[model samples]
Target: MRAVVYDGPFKVSVKQVQQPKIQHPNDVIVKVTSTAICGSDLHMYEGRTAATPGIVFGHENMGVIQEVGAGVSKLKVGDRVVMPFNVGCGHCQNCEEQKSAFCTEVNPGFAGGAYGYVAMGPYMGGQAQFLRVPFADFNALKLPPGREHESDFVLLADIFPTGWHGVSLSGFQPGESIVVFGGGPVGLMAAYSAVLRGASEVYVVDRIKERLDKAKSIGAIPINFDDGDAVEQIIRRRKGKEVDRAVDAVGYQAVEKGGNTEKPNAVLESLVRVVRPTGGVGIPGLYVPSDPGAPDEAAKKGHLMFPFGKFFEKGLTMGTGQCNVKKYNRYLRDMIISGRAKPSFVVSHEIKLDEAPVAYEKFDKRVEGYTKVVIHPND
Candidate 1:
C-alpha cells in the first residue's frame, strides 16, 4: 500500500506502507477512492502542532468498504461509504446527543478525535490505498448508490457541512449579510452555504485571486484585503451596512489582513471590527491550545492578543470548535444527491496519491488555482 507520510516540517512523501486490517469487532477496512488535504493538515505539515514524523496526512475521506468485522451489521464489504473526519463510538453519551466530534469513547483524554491529525487519535489516515474504520456502522455513512457522485459526495466527509455548521453557529438568518475571512476551501464553502441558505449577500476576504475568484463563482463578493482594509472593503461594498455575520476560517496561520507577517488573531480582530453590533461570529478555523512553532512567543502558547474589548463592547457572540461532521453528513449527502449542491466546484486539483507531496507544497504556498486538492488513492 502507498501512503502520504509526514517527514518533517514542510515535508511529506508518498511511500510504500503496510495495508490496514480490521482491528476491532466493529471495524471495517475500506479501499480508499478519494481523500482530501485539509487546511488543518498544513498545521501539522509546518510543524505548528504536535504531529510528529511518519504520521499519515489525510482525514476527509470516502471509499468502498472492502471488508467488515464481525459486529458491523448495517454495512457489508461492498457498501460505498464516507467517514466523517471525527472518530466516534456510537454508544457514547455525546454521540447520542449528535455531538459525535466530542464522543467520549474515542480519545480518552481529549474531547475530540480526528484521523491522522496531531493529538487527535492513533488512527492512521485515509491518504492511502486502504484505511481501517472503527465503529464502522456508526462512523461510515452509506452512499445512496454507485460512485457517480464521487467528487460531490466526498465533501460530506468534512468541509461542506463544516461550512454550513459555521453558518449555523453564527445564527445566520435568511436574507442576512455575511462575511468570511480567508478564501480557502472552507471559506469558499462557507460562502456557498450562506448563498444556498438565503443570505442576501456574501463577502469573502482574501489576498489570493484564485480563491477570491472561486468565491465570485459562488456569487460572493470578493474583498481583496491586499487592496486595502478588508473591513473597509466590506463596508464600502455594502454602502456602510455592517455584515450581520462573520466567519474566521483562517486560524492561527493567518497573516495580517493585507500583510505577510504572521498575526494569529488577525481574523478574529477583523471579525470583531466588521460584524454589526450584536452580530454573531463563527470560528470554524483551527486554533491550537499551544503552537510551539508559531512566529511569536504569545502565539507559541496559543495566546491571542485580540480586541476583546471591542467584541464585548458590541455585544457580539461567538462559536468555535471542530464541526461535528456526522451530525450533518447524511443531510449534506442528500443535498448533493438531489442536485441542490455541488461542492466539487471548489476542487481545484484531483491528483494521484503519488502527487500529494507536490500538492502539499503548492497548496501550502496558496499557489494559483490550488483552492482544494483531492487525492485518488487507488489511481
Candidate 2:
C-alpha cells in the first residue's frame, strides 16, 4: 500500500508503506476512498511540531469497510463510513460524555487523540490505500451508501464539524452577528454554519482575495486585513457596531498584515478587539504547547502576550479546544444529505494519492485556488 509520508520540514511524499490491519478485536480495516489535507497538517509538514520522518499524513478520512473484527457488530464489511480525526476508545469518561476528542484511553497522558497528527496518537493516518479503525462501532459514522455525497461526507470527518464546534463554543444565537478570522476551509465552514444558523450578519477576515471571494459567495462580508486593521475594517462595515461573537480559525501561524512575520496571538487579539463588550469568542484554531519554528522564545515555549486586561474589562467569554467531533458530526451529516450544507464548495482540487505531495506544497503556500485539496486514494 502507498501512503503520504512526512519526510521533513516542507517535505512529504507518497510512498509504498505497510498496510494497516485489524490489530484489535474491536478494530476494522477500511479501504480509503477519500481523504483531505488539513491546515493543521501544515504544522507538522513545516517542522513546527514533533512529527518525524515516515509519519503517514492524513486524518480527515472516509471510505468503505473492507473487513470487520470479531468485536464489531453494528458495522460490517461494505459499510460506508467516515471516521472523525479524533481517535477515541469509546469507553473512556470523555468518550462516554460525547467529548470523544479528549478520550483519555486512546493517547495515554494526553488529553486527546487524532489520527496521523503529531503527539495525537499512534494510529496511522488514512491517506493510504487502507486504514485501521479502532473501536469501530464508536469511531466510525455510518454514512448512506453511495457516492452521491462523497465530497461533502468526507468533510464530516473534520472541518465541517470543527467549524460548527467553533460557532457552538461562542454560544451563538440566531440573528446574532459574528466574525470569523481566517478564510481557509474551516473558517469558510464557520461562516457557512453561521449563515445556516440565521446569523444577522457574517464577516470573514483574510488577506487572500480568493478566500475572501469564497466567503463572499457564501453571503459573508469579507474583510481583507491586508487593506487595514482587521478590527477596524469589520467595525467600519458594521457602522461602528462590534459583532456579537468571533472565531479564531487561524491559530498560532497567523501573520500580520503586509508582512511575513508570524504573530502567535494575532487572531486572538483581533477577536478581542472586534467582539462586542460582554460578547463571546470561539477558537477552533490549532495552538500548540511548543513550536520549534516560532519567531520568539516566548512563542517557542507556547506563551503569548494575550490582551487579558481588555478581555477582562469587556467581560467577554471564550471557548477553546479541539472539536468533540462526535457531538456534531451526525447532525451535520444529515444536513449534507438534505442539501442544507455543501462544504465541498471549499474544495478547489480533487487529486489522486500520487498528487498529494504537490497538493501539500501548493496548499501550504496558500497558492490561489488551492483553498482545499481532497485526495482520492482509491481513484
Candidate 3:
C-alpha cells in the first residue's frame, strides 16, 4: 500500500505503507478511489499545525468498501461511499445535536476527530490505498448507483458540505447578498453553494486571477482584493449597498491583498467592516488555538488582532467553527444528484497519488489555475 506521508514543513512523499484493517466491530476497510489535499492540510504541510512527521496527510475521501465488520449492517462490501472528515460516534450527545464535528468520543479530551489531521485523532488519513473507517454505517455516506459522478461525488466528503455549512452559518437567507473572502476550493464552493441557495448575488474576494475567474464562471461576482481594499471594492461595486452576510473562508494564513505581509486576520476584519448593520458573518476557515508557525509571537499563541469592536458596533452576529459536515452532506448530496449543483467545477487538477507532493507545493503557493487538486490513488 502507498500513502502520502508528511515528512516535515513543505514536504511530503508517497511511500509504501501498511494496509488498513477493520479495528472495530462497526468498522469498514475501504479501498480508496479518490482523495484530496484539503487547504487545511497546508497548515500541517507548512508545519503550522502539530502534524508530526510520518503521518498520512489526506482527509477528503470517497471509496469502495472492501470489507465490512459484522456490526455495520447498513453498508456492505463494494458499496461506494464518501466520508465526512470528522469521525463521530453516532450516539454521542454532540452527534445527537447534529454537531458531529464536535463529537466527544472519537478524540478523547478533544472536541472532535478528523482523519490524518494534526490535532484530530490517531486515525490515519485516506490519501492511501486503503482506510479503516470507524462507525461505518453512521459515518460513510453511500453514493447512488453506478457511481454516476465520481469526481463530483468525491467532493461530498468535505468541501461541498463544508462550503454549504459556511453559507448556513452566515444566516444566508434566499435572496440575501453574500460576500465570501478567499477563492480557494472551499471559498469557490462557498460561492457555488450560495448561488444554488438563491443568494441574490455572491461576491468572492481573492487576489488570484484563476480563482477569481472560477468564481465568475459560477455566477459569482469576483472582487480582486489586489486591486484595492476588498471591502471597499465590494461596497463600491454594489453602489454603496453593503452585503447582508459575509463569510471568512481564509483563515490563519491569510495575507494582505497584493502583498506578502502576513495579516492572518485580514478577511475577518474586512468582513466586519463590510457586512451591513445587524447582518451575520461566518468563519469556516481553519484557525488554530496555537500556531507554532505564526509570523509573530502573539499569533503563535492564537491571539489575532482582528476588529472585534467593529463587529460589535454593527450589531452583527458571528458563527465560527469547523463545519459539521455530516449534518449538511445528505441534503447537499441530493442537490448534486438532482443536477442542481456541481461542486466539481472547482477541481482544476486530478493527479495520481505519487504526484501529491508536487501538487502540494503548487497549491500552497497558489499556483495559477491550481484551484483544487484531487488525488486518484488507483491512478
Candidate 4:
C-alpha cells in the first residue's frame, strides 16, 4: 500500500506502507477511492505546524467500506461513503450539542480527532490504499446513487461543509453583506454559501486573478487585493461603511507581496475594518498557536493586535473553530444531489496519488491556477 508520507518540512513521498486494519469494534476499514489535499496539510508540509515525520497526510476522503466492526450496524460492506475530516463519537456531550467538531471522547485533551496532519490525533491519514475509520457509524457519511459523478459531493468531507460553517458562524441574516477574505477553495465556497443563503451582496477578495475570476463567474463581486488596497475597495463598495459581515478564509502563514513575511493580520484586520459595528464575523481559516516560520512569535499566541477597541465600540461578535462537518454534510449532500449548489467548481486540478508530490509543491507555493487539487488514490 503506497501512502503519501510526510518526511519533513516541504517534503512528501508516496511510499509503500503496511495496510491498516480495523482496530476498534466501532471502526470500519475503507478502500479509499478518492482523496483531496487540504490547505491545512500545507501547514505540516512546511513544518509550520507540528506534524510528525512518516505520518500519512491527507484528510478529505471518499471511499467504499471494505469491512466494518461489530458495533457499526448503520454501515456495512460495500457502502460508498465520504469520511468527514473530523472524527467524533456519536454520544459525546459535544456531539449531542451538534458540535461534533469538539467531540470529547476521541483525543482527550483535544476536542476532536481528524485523519492525519498536526495536532489532530493518532488517526492515520486516508491518502492511502485503505483507512481505518473509528466510530464509523457516526462519522462516515453514506452517499446516494450516482454520487460519484457529483465529485463535488466529496468536497463536503471538508471544504463544502467548512464553507457553510463560515457563513453560519458569521451570524448572517438574509440581505446582509459579506466580504470573504482569501480566494482559496474554502474561501470560494464561503462566498458561494453566502449567496445561497441569500446575502444581498458577497465580496470575494483575493490577490489571485484566476481565483477572483472564478468567484466572479459564480455571481460574486471579485475584489483584487493585489490590484490595490482590498480594504479601501471593500469599504467603498459598502457605501463608505463597513460590511455587514466578514469571513477569514486565510489562516496562518498567509503571504504578502514584496517578499515580506508577516502574521495574518490582513484577514482579521479587514474583518474589523470592513464589518460594521453590531455585525459578526465567521473565521474558518486555520489559526495556529505557533508557527515556527511566522514573522512574529508574539502573534502566535492566538492573540493578534486585533482592533479590540473598535470591536468593542462597534458591538461586534466573532465565531471561530473547525467545521462540525457531520452536522452540515447531510444537508449539503442533499443540496448537491438536488443541483441547487455545486461546490466542485472549486477544484482546479485533478491528479493521481503519485502526482500528489508535484501538485502539493505547486499549491504550497500558491502558484497561479492552483485552487483545489483532488487526488485519486486508485489512479
Off by over 4 Å in 1: 257-259
Between candidates 3 and 4, the one scoring higher on lDDT is: 3
Clash count in backbone of candidate 1: 0
* lDDT by residue (tens digit), candidate 2, 147-169: 99899999999999999999998
> Which residue pairs clash within candidate 4?
243-274
What is the model-wide C-alpha lDDT for candidate 4? 0.87
- TM-score attained by model 2: 0.99
TM-score of each: 0.98, 0.99, 0.98, 0.97
> Model 3: runs farther than 4 Å from truth?
none
- Per-residue CA lDDT of candidate 3, range 1-379, in tens? 9999999999999999988888889999999989988999988898887778999988899999999998999998989999999999999999999999999999999999999998798899999999999999999999975657888988988898888889989999999999999899999988999998899989999889999899999899998877889888888888999999999899888898665988877887888888999999999998888987788999999999978787788899888899898998888888888988888898999999988999999998987577789999986
Sort by lDDT, top down from the best: 2, 1, 3, 4
Top TM-score prediction, candidate number: 2
Q: Give the Å shift of residue 254 in candidate 4.
A: 2.9
Q: What is the lDDT for 37 in model 3?
A: 83
Q: What count of clashes does model 4 give?
A: 1
